[model samples]
Every structure is written in C-alpha cells, then in structure tokens.
Target: MSVSSQHEGLCLRYPEPLGPQANVSYEAAVSMLMRAIQLAQHTPFVWGYIDKPQEGHIYLIFMTQQLPFPPDGIRYQDQEQKIIMPAGPGRELEVMEVKFGFVPNSSDTTAWRVRRRYRMHKGGHPQLVLIHYGRGQPMPIMPNLNQPVRNYPLRPINEPALFVMGEKIGQKVYPNQHSGPAERPGPPGMGMSFGGIGNQQAMLAQQNNNLEALERRSQRDRSGSMNARAPPPARIEDDDSADESDMMSTRTLALTRYKRNHELMNEVFMYAAFSRKKEFPPPKSPYSVFDIANVEARVAKMTAEIDELRSKAEARREARSNADGAVGDDPGDVSMEVSGTTEEVPT
Candidate 1:
C-alpha cells in the first residue's frame, strides 16, 4: 500500500523524464534511503537495498563512523560492533537487519558481529552484518542485481552531496529532532563531514551567489543602464554537473514567465470584449484593474460617441423623408432600406 500528498498548482501537468546524467537532490535521495532503513528494521516484513558493491561499502562506513547512533535495529554487517544512541526517553526500540547485495546469504550475524568487532579493535576493514532480530526470524533481504529498483531518486557520485540529516533523518524512525551546542562526532577516514541544517543553508546561500550575479546582469539588461554585451553565465570549475543543475533551475524560471505572459493575455482579451466598467470584478480577480477609475472615463467617452452617431442617423433619416418613420421591436428587423448607406442599429 502507498500513500501520497499533492499540491494542485505546483503539480506539473507533464513532468519531463530525468536523464541518466541528471543529478538528484541530495536531501531527497538521503531521505528515501533513511525510509528504506526504517522499513528494514522497524517493519516485520523484509525491506532492503541493492546497490553497487563500492556504494554499499561507503554507506556502511559513513553510517557507523559519522552517525550519532544506530536506530533500534540498525546493525552494520562488516564491522564487529554494537552501536547505541544517546540516552533519552519516549524512544522506541527497533529490530533492524541489513544484507549487502553482493554478500553471501549463508553469513551468520552474531559470528560476523564478533569478527567485525575484533577487526575494528585491531584497526582494519571488517566483515560486517547488522542483525536486529531474533535467531529464528529471517533477516531482511536485498533485491537481486537484475531486480534493482529503477526510477528511484538517487544521487550520482559526481553530484555535490549537500545535505544535513541532523541527529536523525526525516520525521521518521528515530531522533525526530535535535538542537544543542553538542559537537557531534563525524565520520573519520572518509572526506565526509556532518553539519546541521544551518550549515547546509550556508552552502546553498554560497551557491546562489552565482545566481544573484546572473540577476544583476539581467537588471542591467532590463534597465539599459550599460550598453555592453551581456555577460555569459558563470560556470563552476567542475565539468557539466553545475551546468546541468543550472539548466534545470533556468528551465523552471522560463516556464514560469511563459505561463504568466499567457495568463496576462487572456485577462486583457476578456476585458476588451466587455469593458471592466460594465463588469467591475473583485479586486483580486484575474482581470486587470490598474486603470479602473480611468475605465469609467473611457466608458463615458464611448457613450458620447454613440450618442453623436444617433444624432447623425436622425438627421439623415429626417433629410431622406419626413414621413419615413417606423417602430420595430425586433433587433433583426430591416425595414426602410436605404441604398448605398450603412444603417446604424437603434441604441
């Protein structure tokens, strides 16, 4: 069973397909992985992950080294160690079991944990297996290589992994939230580090400085303040990854402008057909109301023009024949035809 949340206007009518080279948002990818872990340990049914051997190894190392503590059942299979979270109340214990995709199925968790512990004490790579279940119960199963989930959002190694999962991941499975001056121990050996949401926001702000530079160029263009060739967009030194991200960002802005222009055109046409004065809609209506008071002046002018036209028609009718008088209730009536002359409708 699946549950979903949707926002109407924000929903894309036709979402573009993500190319193989596209970069997934770091937070989104990590959040999904956290969900998978949560499912593996918390749910009675088997839940698992299947990834490249190298990625699997990196993930194991990162979690054990960097993370504060494993949620109830999270057991790192390779290293022989038991990780526990900081003391707290209102906490639920989980039973987690994880299996590497390429690892052998016959591996024993307790024995493997002992070995991992021995090797870590000796300082080396350990054959790790996480067990958060009873001996009689089955371990979580990893998807087969051929059965690897497709279309799941995941970040490519080349992409900048700029996200902070904090003391816990998302609003699920464990440390729901955290705030303090406690200097958390981060992952060692690996070039990775952990920072709270504040650090991630700083990184994002630094990145957007490039975008702000682009905005200044645009402002120059719109104002014609400087007569010069527009500056080319600034590209990050790292090859096409930054370019790809910037392209995705720009496409959204362009599409937004396109929609806004179309909406404005429609509103203008609606007002043209029926004067705003005739149908003064709500202030917040989509129709234009910039020159609302002026519209009344324009309407009065139009009425005067129509009155002048009626006077001219009366004079022509009187000149044609004094006895040429007729009353017709039907708007379609065409009596008293005058040749070589256009007839004005009775106002």
Candidate 2:
C-alpha cells in the first residue's frame, strides 16, 4: 500500500499494540486507544479507532470526521500468528454505523452524521459523530466528541480535499442528482456511496455555481440597475413680491453710477499733470455751479479725501509686502492680506 502525504508520517509503528485487549475489556481498551490517537502526530480535531473481539476475527473499527484521508498503509500485525489487518478506507475497516444493521451490505462502513446547534458565544459549529459496528455485535455507544468547525462560507473544495472530508451531510451536500448511491463504483480505491467520489466533486461544482449566481444578483442590486426610477427635477417658484423687480433695478442704477464716478475720477487725474489740461467748466446754471466760496469748500474737501485714500493704499501695500515676507520666512504659514486699498470715494 502506497502512503499519501496528507495522511502519512502520522502512521504509528506500533510493535506494541495501541489496543491489545479482549472483547470484555473493549471499553477500557477504547479509552486507552482514544488517548493514544489524541497524542499521535497530526491528531485530527475529532477522531477515534478501536479493536474488539467480534464473531471470530478482531473487528478493527477506525472512525474519524476531521482527518483528510482515511487511515491507510497503517496496520496491526499479530507477530505470533503473522496475521495482518492492513488499513484502507472501508476496505480494511468498517464504515461507520448510525444504528445496528441499519444497512448492512459492505464489509467496512465509514458513515457520519452532523448536527448544528447554535452557540451563544461561538455562533455555530458542527457536531459530528463517527460510529462503526462489528459483525453480530450491537453498535457501540460512543461518547460525544466536540470539535471546532471552520465556520467558513460554503465554497467548493477541489477534487482532492473533498475526498478527505468524505461524505458530508446536512448543509455540506449540494443540490441536483437524486439523494442516493451511485449505479457504478467510483474511481479505483475510493469509497462506495450514492455517486461515489464523483458525486462529491459534482456537489462542490454545483455549490460553486450557486454561490456565483447569488453574487451576481447581489452586485446587480448594489448597482441599483433593476427597475429603478430617476429622481424628479427640482422646481422653482415664480411667485415673488411686485417690489422685487424694483429693488433689482435700483441696484443696477447704483452700480452704473459707481462706474461713472470711477471714469470721471480717472479723467480728472489724467489732466492733473498735463500741460494742455482743459480749465474746469462752469455749470450751465449758476445754482448748479454754487457760490465761489461753496465751490472752494467742495474742492478742498475732495483734495483731503484723495490724500486720505493715498495714505490708506500705501499702508495696505506695505502690509501686504510684510505678509509676503512673513510667508517666505515660515513655509507653513498662509498669507491672506489684501494687496491694495479699495475705498469707494463718494463724489
């Protein structure tokens, strides 16, 4: 028998029997055997193997749910008699049993049953049991072994791994194909089952397809591309007070006056230093021109205002230059100073 990497190296070369005992001493023997399996290399999360006298031959029953491969290439030899019980999946061992004589056809059985119970702290874990029955002996009452299941999202395992966790029940099985055994035997050396090893591979493939379909539907829902309606356009109300338009018109007139004042100021400054500067024209009416003393007073007020604006502009420019220098000195600081004065000089 060839050894497999997945289940190799864990083999026990027991010149000493792991369980060398009698049928009457079966309970004690199983207890000792279980402890040995626990200490063995690559001890599966939950598993056990025991030998007991049944009929004429020693019934070597090995049952496990966690191990990837069946215990193969491992054996017990009665050195005194030279009898060898080689290890293989159900071929050299009994397949597990749920109840005595429930379905007695194969010499070796490896059946398993799984039940899920909700846990307050851990959420959920599978309760797996593997029981094997020897010929003409009542099924042994086994202790419940607790193993932490990997609560991974259901996905298809490849052909090899699927064979390891063999014959999954409950949520582990997939849809399609009748729920029974296969017509022909599966691949060579693989166990006999509803669809053999191929059934498990098919079940995994179907599970993958189902998950892919669900993911596609979830993506479509997230994109909001299914029977969705666009939002309505925002509406504007035309209802406003009759004086609203009048207010806008007044604002426009004020802006026009401000612009005209700016143009007049520029023209006055342009002529201030010109040799051909025109003389100030008198108003068409004497009332518009005002008395000479009043005109002189208005000119004096305008000159004072111009001087104040120049002082403010120079101060603002100096402040901005200082701010620029500060910014250059401190790379992290931001300067937000106005560059020049912008006083609205009333005419």
Candidate 3:
C-alpha cells in the first residue's frame, strides 16, 4: 500500500493510471518529460534560478535587483518573475516535491521554488499522457491526450512561446496546403473620419442655421420691414435642455406658419366665392375716382353731423350738472334757467 502525505506543493498519484500491473511506455516517459519541461518553460526565471538535476525539476529564483523584497508565492511566480504557470503540490516519496530556499548572492538574496510530478499509462496506437493546471491529484485519472482540448496547449513548448512563435508552431503542427495573397490596407478612397455621427451632427446644425435665417427673413417680410435681416441666436449648450427647447420652439413656429397659411388660403377662397355670387357684381370702380368738389361736399356734411352730436352731448352734461348743483345748494327752490348757449345754461 502506498501512503501519501500532503503539503503546500505535494504531488499525489493519478487514480486510474495507478495501482498494480500498470505498464509505463516510452511515450508516457516522453509526455511526462514534456510536461516537466513545459512547466519549467512557462515558469519565468528572473535575476536568478535554481537547478535541481536530481528530481528532474528546476527552481526559478524571483528576486530581481530592482525589487525591494522577495515577493510572496503567487506574486513571486507571476509578477516578479513573469511566470505564467503556477507551482504545483510539493510532496516527497514518489510525489512531486518542490524544494525552496533563499540563496544570498552578494548584496541580494533570491527565493527559489520548483515543481515536479509523473504518472504511467498504456493502450493506444500512440499512447496518451495528460497534464493541466492543477496540483497533481488522484482523480478519475487525467484524460487521454488523443482527444484535443481547445485553447489549451497540447505540447510543452506551446505553453511558454509567444503568439508569433505559437502561430509558426501551429502551422507546423497542422500543415495547410492552401496559400493566399497578402491582406490590403483599410477602406478605399480619400479616407476621412467624416462618415459617422459627427458629420451628421454638423450637417444638422447647418440645416438648423439655414431654417432660422429663413424664419427671421419671413418674420421681417410679414412685418413689412426691408431693413430687417437678422439670424437666430446660437445655442449655448449641447445638453438635453437645449435640445428639448430647440425642438419645441421649432415645432411651435412650424405649427404657427401652417395655421397662418391655412387661414390666408381659406380667406382667399371665401373672397373669390363671394365675388362670384349673382347678387353682387364686381365693383364698377376698379380704382374709384371722385371729383374734388364731391369730396369737399361729403367732408363738410360729415363735419356738420359731428358738430351737432358734440353740441347735444355738451348740453345734456351741463343740464345734469346744473340740476344736481341747484338741488344740493337750495332744496326748496326749483327754478328753471335757460340760455341759447347750451354749454353753460341749464334747460
């Protein structure tokens, strides 16, 4: 019976692939080596690194000259050293063990950590070995590598390399026969950034200015002023309040003009219909011409009528005032005072 001890970085056995009578193959060995190499390659080494040739593992030091202190585990592995893969479970006695310590070199001392693990399996035209991002544990044993995993590196080199290197390796791994011409630059023509909402906004503003100018001109014309040539004021802010106000004002002006035009048209139509009626013929005087003597006579008659009305009003007012004054001044006396000058005498 195999006894297991657990620790921070302890490597435990894989379940199905373990137990008695399990055969290990060259392919398994190669895969395990690849896994180890892949882990190390992905594990970045900064100013210093450790070599553990005995366990077939490497410890990378993460104390650079630039840093003030040796960072914590994940920080040491990830940020300071810029390593991608994490250190796995470290155990002893057939389990993956990572030995870490600080080795002082001159003025600075760097912390070093290493991870290692292995398993054996069989049965395939080409046998399968699997590795992934976890502390090695006995589970429904790691899956067969024959089936592909998407977005995960298949081989060890893939985990460490950059995009360009991966692309080249990818092409090598799965060769394609098809070839094509190089891709061309961006969109055609005199390429300008004026094709979007900015252009539309500018155009709308210009149209609004034109509308305002026309509206001002129309207002001036309706008021019968030739010297009136003024444009609408500029909008100060580009916020919701300004937008709502502008829209409301524009709608009001449009409605007003529409109503005015409709009324004018209706009046014109009514006048036309009335003029065509059989009872009243068109006026005989297209532009009525009257003699100067006739005009003078009419003016004199109008003046005489006005004067008569004015005299009557004045006489009434004077009579009312005198009667009131006499009544108040002498209640017992009711005397009548009449004069041809109706303006002053009571009737």
- Which one wins on TM-score? 1
Backbone clashes, candidate 3? 5
- Which pairs, if any, clash in model 3? 9-89, 9-90, 10-89, 10-90, 10-91
Model 3 scores worst on lDDT over the 10 consecutive residues at 161-170
lDDT, candidate 3, 169-236, per-residue tens: 11111112111100112122111111122344553344344434433433444354224435424533
Q: Which regions of candidate 3 deviate over 4 angstroms?
A: 1-288, 331-347
Residues 256-336, candidate 2: write the lDDT tens digits.
458768898989887786748578876687476568898899999999999999999999999999999988886562434
Candidate 2 Cα deviation (angstroms), residue 109: 16
Query: What lDDT score belongs to each candidate, Candidate 1 first?
Result: 0.30, 0.30, 0.30
lDDT of 1 by residue, 1-347 (tens): 01111110011110111112112223322322333232222111111222222221212211222112222222333323343322124221221334322223334322222111111111111212221121222334433322322333432222112111221111121222121101122122111112123455553444344334433433443355223435434533332254223322343334445776888898999889767566555578565656887988999999999999999999988976754433333356554556967676565
Each prediction's TM-score against the native? 0.18, 0.15, 0.14
Q: Measured by TM-score, how close is model 1 to the native structure?
A: 0.18
Q: In candidate 3, how many Å is residue 134 off?
A: 70
How does residue 36 of candidate 2 score in lDDT?
A: 28
Which residues of candidate 2, in runs, are more than 4 Å off? 1-10, 13-15, 18-26, 30-66, 69-133, 137-347
